[model samples]
Structures are given as structure tokens and as C-alpha cells.
Target: MTTRARNVISAAIVAGLLLPAAPALAQSDEQQRIRKLEAEVSALQRRVFPGGDGRYFEPEIGGTSQGTTVTAGTPSTTALTDILARLDAMEASLQTLTGQVEVNANTLQGLTTRMAALEQSGAAPTLASAPTPTPTPAASSPSQASTTTANNLTAMTGGASSQPARPAPAASGPSSQRLAAVQAIAKPKTDDAGDDEYSYGFRLWDAGYYPEAQQQLTLFVEQYPDHWRATYGRNLLGRAYLDDGKAREAAPWFLNNYQADRNAARSPDSLLYLAESMIALRDTDRACIALAEFGETYPAVAAGRLQSQYEANRAKVTCTN
Candidate 1:
């Protein structure tokens, strides 16, 4: 054969072989793409429906007219829309929760601020004076007599009596002498000085030296907070203020003593006194609440010496049943 003729025939044979291979390569590429798409869809299905009972797209929407042939790279638009809607709903819910948290934080902040003010001032603001209610003289317990006298004194002082801002009745010679003796008595030097210190304050209170008793008991409680007598001292401190005609200033101390330990030795007494202070402040509602709490919390104690005191105070106000 001639060279040009042989070259032409060789080129034709090569063309035939290459053309067949081109179709085979195209078919293989298409199969690889389909397999990749199927793998991606399987992963998405596993993630969206881990239990495998549910799939992202409905079976009716599969890309087959005659059989269950699923088309590669095709997803249900409605499923995508539902997922987006769910995401939007979750965002809205998160925003609502965040707003509630902020509101709670603000409320907590307000409470903290009020507590700080109460601590700094050592009392709440004095309320306006109202007509002081008097307890009838039916129950003549010694405790009741003493408390009635105190109420009369408070009403007189708060209404129009020419008392100083703080009462200092220790000016009389007998009171002065008693106070001097009390001052001379040294605090007991022992691991437990609580008893002696509390007794000293009690003596001052009994002797009508309320200011001195307040100072002494305040120091005692601060020094011996864990001591058994601290409860007594704290309650007595409030009583000193109450007897001094400063019921508003005394109420917080009484409340603190009762709330510090409701089962403590003097906690029941403190609750009674807290109610008394409330009555003096003309807050009959809170006074009744304090009285109710006392009766409920210490039923046994309320039936004892406190019965007369409770009845006397209960007579002072009309509480709702």
C-alpha cells in the first residue's frame, strides 16, 4: 500500500475506537455523579431523620412515573419551607425567654436595692401618724400592763409630747446612779461572756435606760452572734427601741431576730414584739400577719405566757379570719 493511503486508513480506525470510548467515558461520568448525589442525599436523610422511619421528601414526589425511582439532586420544596418555618419559630421562642429573664433580673435588682437601703438606714422610713388604737384592760397580765403602758407612752410621744428625737430618761438621779453602777460592772472575762453581757443590757432595760440598753445589746449581738443569749439580746434591743417610742426604728430589729432563727429561744417573743411594733406603726395588716405566723409557728409557746400578750395585741386590731 502507498504511505498516504495507509495513513488515511489508520486515522479512520483510530477515530472509530476513540468515538466508542468517548460514549463509554460519558456514561461512566454520569454514573459517578449520580452516585455522589445519592450519597449526599443519604447523609441528609440520616441527619434529618435518624430513626430512618421518616424521610425529608414524600415518596409520591420521587422522580418516577412508572416505579419508585428517586431522582438525584431533587428535594421537596415544601419540606425545606417547613424546616425554615420551624427555625423561625424557635428564634421567636428564644427571644421571649430572653425577655422574661431580663424582667426577673430587674425584679431581683429592685429587691436588692431595697434591702441595701434598709440595712444602711437601720430602719424603714417612718410612716404618717395615725390614731393609736388602745387595748382594753380586760386581760390584766403583768406583761399586758407593761405593754399597754408602752403603747400609751408611744402614742403620747408620737402625737404631741415634747420628747427629744431619741428618748434619754436616764437623767433622773436614781436612774443616773443605776446607770453608773451598770457601767462600772465589767464584762465577764471568759470564753462565754454572752450571759453576763445580756444580763447587763436587761438590767438597763428594766431600769428604764432604753438608750443604754440599745447600745449594750447592739454591741453584745455583734460580738456574740452565735451565743444562745444573742437571741435574747437582739429581741431586747428591739424592745428597748419600742419602749423608747421609736417603734418604726424597732420593727426591723424584731423582724431580723425572728427571721434569723424561728426556733431560737427568743424568736417567738420577737415575733410578738414585731406585731406590737407593727400595731404601733398603724399597720394593722402586717401586725395581724405577724400574729398569725406566731400562732401557727409556735402553738405551744403561744398558749403559754404569750397567750395574754397575743390576746392583748389581737384586741388592739381587727384581723381578717
Candidate 2:
């Protein structure tokens, strides 16, 4: 009885000891597996996230994370879509800007070509380099004080007027009115040697500026009745009217010029323009009369070329009378 009881008691104690060891061993294995998994996850984050800010975690605070961490490996399709949309918008803007740049380039090229053509055509002389003039002598007995004053002025200027350019008087475009004003001031002065009526007018209306030319020419003719260049002035006036798209106004002007200077070389030219205007007005009979008159008056002139052209054109014109 004693031996049997002793063996049973030993067996029971050993079983109890084995049961406690099994639980502890299992806990140790679980802890080791968790450490290995943690290390692997840290290595993966360093490779994939780059300082924990690849659209995910940010820097760590003292004890706990500041913002809620989104679960890793979840595809943020919304953020990627937003980035693609912004890129598309930028591309579209770039295309529009490129189109505008091309249009501007074409406009600039056209402007440059036109400017070059205008420059090549002879224009008014540039005012940049004025000629140096010789000094003028004063009357005899010119005192030293007077000479000094003159020299001082000469030193101040290179013998040119430094007076402020008189502001051009305002006008509502150069019309007959402006011509009238100048004619009033310059009429009796026409006989004066210093009078520069014709030249003044020419300067104002130069470069084929027809309307301005006509206004200046009118002033010159109004001021001087039988002056040497009076007929020349009238001829220019007619040509100016033609350039200004005033054919009817120009017709009488040419006739007046031709009548005033019958022997002038410009007589045939004035007659030709007059005929052209008459034809434009549908007065073919008068135009032919003018043409015949020009042919008889000046048979050999540069303007005679216009007469032949007119005859050829008349062949096609429908005559009213």
C-alpha cells in the first residue's frame, strides 16, 4: 500500500511541473516573433517612405504621434487623380501661351517689313545734323561790349537758334482755315525779300501729305497773286487734292494751273489730271476735250504718256453725250 501511493504522488507532481513550463515557452516564442516583425516593418518603411513623409507619417513628437496615421499600403487614388488633373491644366495653359507667342511674332515681323519699306522710300531729310554756319559781322565801330555779347551767344550755341521751338499752334487738322491765317499774316509780305511764303507752305505739306499740302498751297497762292512760283504753287495744290481723294476739288485746281502757266512743263500734267477727274465724274466729252487740249498745248512732256493711256481708256468708256 505505501509503495503504490508514493509512485502515484510523484507522477502527479511531474505532470503539474510540465503544464507550467508549456505556457511560459509559448509566451517567449510569441514575443520573439513580434520583435522580428517590428524590425522588418521598420526596414520596409525606411525604403518606401523616406523620412516618413511620402504622403503619410510625419516627424515624431515627444511621446505620441501628432496626427492620426492613415493605414499603410492603402492606395490613395483621390490624391493621385488630383495631381494628374493639375498637370493637365498646366499643359493646356502652356499650349495657349505658345499660340499667343506665335501670333505676336508674326505681327512683329510684318511691322518690321513695313517699317523697312517706309525707311527705304525717300523721306524728309533727318534733322539730326545741322550745318555749322559762319559768324556774321556787326556794323563798323562795333564796341568791345557788343562783340563780347555776340561771342557769348555764339559760345552758348553753335550759330543756331536755341530758342524753344514755338509750340505749333493747335488746329483742327490743317484745312483752308489754317491757310487763311497764314495768308493774312503773309499777304503784303510777299513783296518783301525776306518773305518765305512758298517755302513755308511746302515745308508744312511735304511727303505727299495731300490734305496738309493743299492747305499750305492755298495759303501761298492767297498771299501772292502773280509771284514767280504762284503757278507752281497752284500745280502742287492740284496734285495735293488728288492725293487727298478729292478728285472733283482737284479738277478746277489743275485747270487754273494750266491756264495760269500755259507754257509751264506742269501744264500738261495739270490738264491730264483734270481730264482724269472729269472722266471719273462721268463727263467723257469734257475729259476728251481736256485731253485734246493737253496734247495741243504740250505735245512732248512726261504727262503726255497719260494722254495715250486716256485715249485707250476712252475706247471702253460709255459716253453720255
Candidate 3:
């Protein structure tokens, strides 16, 4: 009931009010510290893994005393698995391609071997017994001269005879005349050696012995210039060079075959080979022109192998419509 008792009672009331406010202030400060720690963790996560949703810290589960642990995201796991699968698939594809390349190489080698064998066994023509002899002026009468001339013309225009003629022995004017007279009287002899030589050359060509084949064919042409097989020999020589991958060298021989004997059986064949040579030389325009000439000149015989060859070459050269 005195002045000191009243002051003590006022101080107690003020202390009661201040105690509740102090607990609220402490709780607010704790919340601010937690927020600041979360901001620092988020900034570190961004710097460590910029483009990925990598592992990051989460707020403690129960309380601030609990330890922070990393948890993986579903997207990151899925991305890693996908990358491994893609690498495996790429390895499998590369292995498959390598196997296919080896198989193709082996197949090509087998084809080449088989083709050479076939060519070697199938190229020679059957041999004949003998060539007819030229007529002698003294033995035949005037009326027979025309007939003899006609026969000579027929033999010249004819395709290759199965039997080639033997070369006459070297002689001067009178001796040559006597030898011719005797030959006209005597029966013609078959040149079996010449036929064998021709067959050997053709077999060489077929067996891919190109250099040897060229030499043999050239010798045959030179030694037996008037033989029935002369035209074929020239054409085959050109083919040997062409098949040997000497297109530029082959062109001249093919051209010579056609120019020297246009009416010969293999003349058209020579033209076709010439076109092929031109294509090998990358002269498409010239190849096309040569093909046109072949078509114009040999319309009668253009339905079989020659026609097929022309069509294939035309496509290869990509000729205009």
C-alpha cells in the first residue's frame, strides 16, 4: 500500500509482456539463417552442374541437426542409359559393315577366276583340212581364166578358213614362177602348225596372258597376211590390248582392221571394239559417233550379240536421247 510497492508491481507487469516478444524475435532470426543457407546451396549447385539437373542438397528432413544427402533425378539416369545404348548400337553397325565389305571382296575374286577359266576353254574354232590353191596361167585355158578369177575373189571375200595356208619358200622371179606352176599342179597341203599356233594365242588371251597373247597374235597377222583368219587375228590383237587396259593402244589396231578390210567377217566387230576403246578413253562423243556408224553400216547383222553390246555401251556413255 506504500509508493515502493506500487513501482515493483508495474515492473513485474512489463517483464511479463517482454518475455513473449523475445521468443518470437529468436524464432524469426533462426528462419532467416535457414533461408540464407538454402540460397548458398542453390548457387553452388548451378555453378557445379550448369546444364544438368544433377544431385543437389535438400532441406534437412527432421531438423537442422540432420545431415544433407544427394538424390539423383530420373531424367539424368535415363539420359546416361540412353547414351550407353547408342554407343553399343554404333559398334554393332560398324562390325556388320566390315563383314559385308569382306564378303564382297571375296565374291569379286571368285568371279574373276571363273571368268578366266571359261574364256580359256571356249575361244578356239574348229580346224579345217586345207585351203584351195590359186590357179596357174599355163595349166588353165582362156575360158577358165574368168572362172579362176571369180574363185580367187570368192576366197578373198570369204570369212576365215579353218585351215591356214603354208608360206611359200623364198625365190627369185623365174624360180618363183616355176614354184607357182608346181604348186598349181600339186595338191595343197594343210598347215596344222599354223592352226595350233593360232589356238595357242587365243588360249593365252582367254587365260589373261595379255602380253604373250599380243605378241602371238601380232606374229600370226604378219606371217599369214593373206590367210583367211587374218581379219580375226587383227581384231583379236586389238582385244588383247583393250582387255589389258591399254585402250589408247587398242584404238589404232581396231581402226586398222576396219579400214584394211571393211568387207571381212570381223570388220563390224572391230568397229564395236573401237567404240569400246573410245569409251575407255573417256571420249564419249567419239564413242557415240562410232556406234552410230556401226548401226548405219551393219543393219543386216545388228540383232544379236552386237546389238546387245551397243546398247550396253550406249548406257555406259550416257548418250543423249
Candidate 4:
């Protein structure tokens, strides 16, 4: 009637089957009983467990003194019956697993045999394998659509939220070359003279020359070691690497800023860039720590305002056992 009853019947039949003195007629009767028991177990398992994952289970306490009542389909009553059945005849677990493994092995053997036959027949030679697919990088950042969407998201979601400081765009491209040819790199300006090189970088960045900008920014740092713009130069180079989908490349540049001169005006921006780089690299441990440090180091700065956001993000991070 129920799953447990069927399991008990099967075990009883198995015991009877093992009896050496049992007669042939009695043995046939025992086999019929076992079949009947297995059928009952299957039915009860379907009704109680119902699905692959939602299997029946029994609590620590055994069934009622009056014998466990199966209230048709109540979760506790019927499910308990199913669970007790499964637990009682633990051999069923091994049988089920073995059946599945046997089926799979047979199928695989058949497939292998067929394949070998075909290859010998020369109907489908070289069917053993093909080259695996190599993954290319995902789409690069700084596309018009991507920029617009990111800007929109930043504006809308973070109106009340703190805006993380961003490094300037990449500044190495054809424009930088034009600027180099037209203007002195030393007297860089927006209006005239070295304006060409200065403007060239921005244009190259706008044209998506992220790798080029990374190189130019490195050069800029060398040329203007004492200038205030040197800080921004390194910052932009890091961003260029980020835009080019190179998180590791960007990380060191940002980290350099994090440890730059404490008295400098760009120190806050430097820390901000470092944190951003860490986040991009998915190095949450370091990123959160960096943000917390940012909060302490620049207590009143806008970049320091990112403390709450970083903590909130940290709340969602978890280490699995």
C-alpha cells in the first residue's frame, strides 16, 4: 500500500529466497511477492517524493504507535513513508546508481564501436576530434553606446549615491603624433604651441586608441616628472589599459598612485583610481580595503564618500566552504 510496506515485503522475500529448505513453489511465490513489493514502492515513491529533488524524508522519530498514517498526500505523512522506505532498503540506492552507470557505459560502448567501424570502412575518417574553441576577449569599452549607457547608469543609480572618482581618458593616438610634429611636448597647451600634442592625445582617446594612450601616458610621466599633470598622466594610462580590457595592466598604475606622495593634491584621485582598478580586477578583498583606507586617509574628500558603497558591496561577497 505504502512505500515502507513494499520495502518490508521485499526484504522479507529476499530473506525467504535465501532459505535453502524453501520449496520451488514457495520460491516462485516469494519472487511474486517481491515484484509486488517493488511495484508498491515505486507507486509510493512517485506519490510521496513526486520529483527528483523533492524526495521523501523521515524525522528522527519513527512512525506512530498505531503505525504511520499516510494521509493521502500530506507532506509529512506520505513523504515520511517514502523516506522510511528508502532508508530501510538502503540497497536500492546502490542499485539505482549502478543501473544508471551500466546504461551510460553500454551507450558509450555502442557509440565507440560504431565510430570505429565507420573509420575502418573509411566512410568518416578523422572523426576522433577537432580543435577546441579559443576564447577571444569580449567587446572593448568606450564604444558610443557603451559610454552612453554607463554614463546614464552612473547618473541615474548614483544621483544620491557617491560617484567614484574616474581617471581621465586615454591620450595616445594619431593626434599625439600630429601634436608631436606640430608642437613642442614641453610647452603643452590647449590653445596653441604644444596644443597639438595635448589635443592629439584626447582625439586618439576619443578614437579608441587605448593601447596607444597607455604608451603615451608612460612617456608623459617621464617628460613631466615634476609637473602636476604627471599624476593625471599615469592615471589616464591606467584607464586606457582598463578600457582595453586589461585589468592586470591597469592595476599597477593605479596602485602606484595609491602610494604616491601623501602631500600631493592628486593623492585622493590616486587612491580612487587604485580602488577602481581593484574592483575591475575583481579583487574585492583589496578593493574594499582600499576604499576603507581612502575613507580614513581623505576623511572629507568626495572620493572618501565611496566608503558606504564599498561596504555595501562587501556585504554581498562571501567565501564558500
Cα shift from native, residue 76, model 1 (Å): 99
The TM-score leader among the candidates is: 1
lDDT of 3 by residue, 2-112 (tens): 899999999999999899999889978877787677667667656754653443333232234354333333345665676689899999999999999999999999977
Backbone clash total for model 3 is: 0
Candidate 2 root-mean-square deviation in Å? 21.0
Instruction: Give each prediction's root-mean-square deviation over alpha carbons.
Output: 17.7, 21.0, 21.2, 27.4
- The TM-scores, one per candidate, come to 0.44, 0.36, 0.43, 0.36
Model 2 per-residue lDDT tens digits across residues 2-108 = 99999999999999989999988997786667667656765675676565654533233222234233344425475467568989999999999999999999999
- Please report the candidate that would top lDDT against the real structure: 1
Local error of candidate 1 at 7, Å? 99
lDDT digits (tens) for residues 71-183 of candidate 1:
54325686688679999999999999999999999999997787545323222222222323332223234432344443433342235332123334455555667658767
- Total clashing pairs for each candidate: 0, 0, 0, 3
TM-score: model 2 vs. ground truth: 0.36
Order of models, best lDDT first: 1, 3, 2, 4
Which ten contiguous residues of candidate 3 have the minimum total lDDT?
Answer: 135-144
* List of clashing residue pairs for candidate 2: none
Off by over 4 Å in 3: 1-190
lDDT of 2 at 15: 99
lDDT against the true structure, each candidate: 0.67, 0.55, 0.63, 0.52
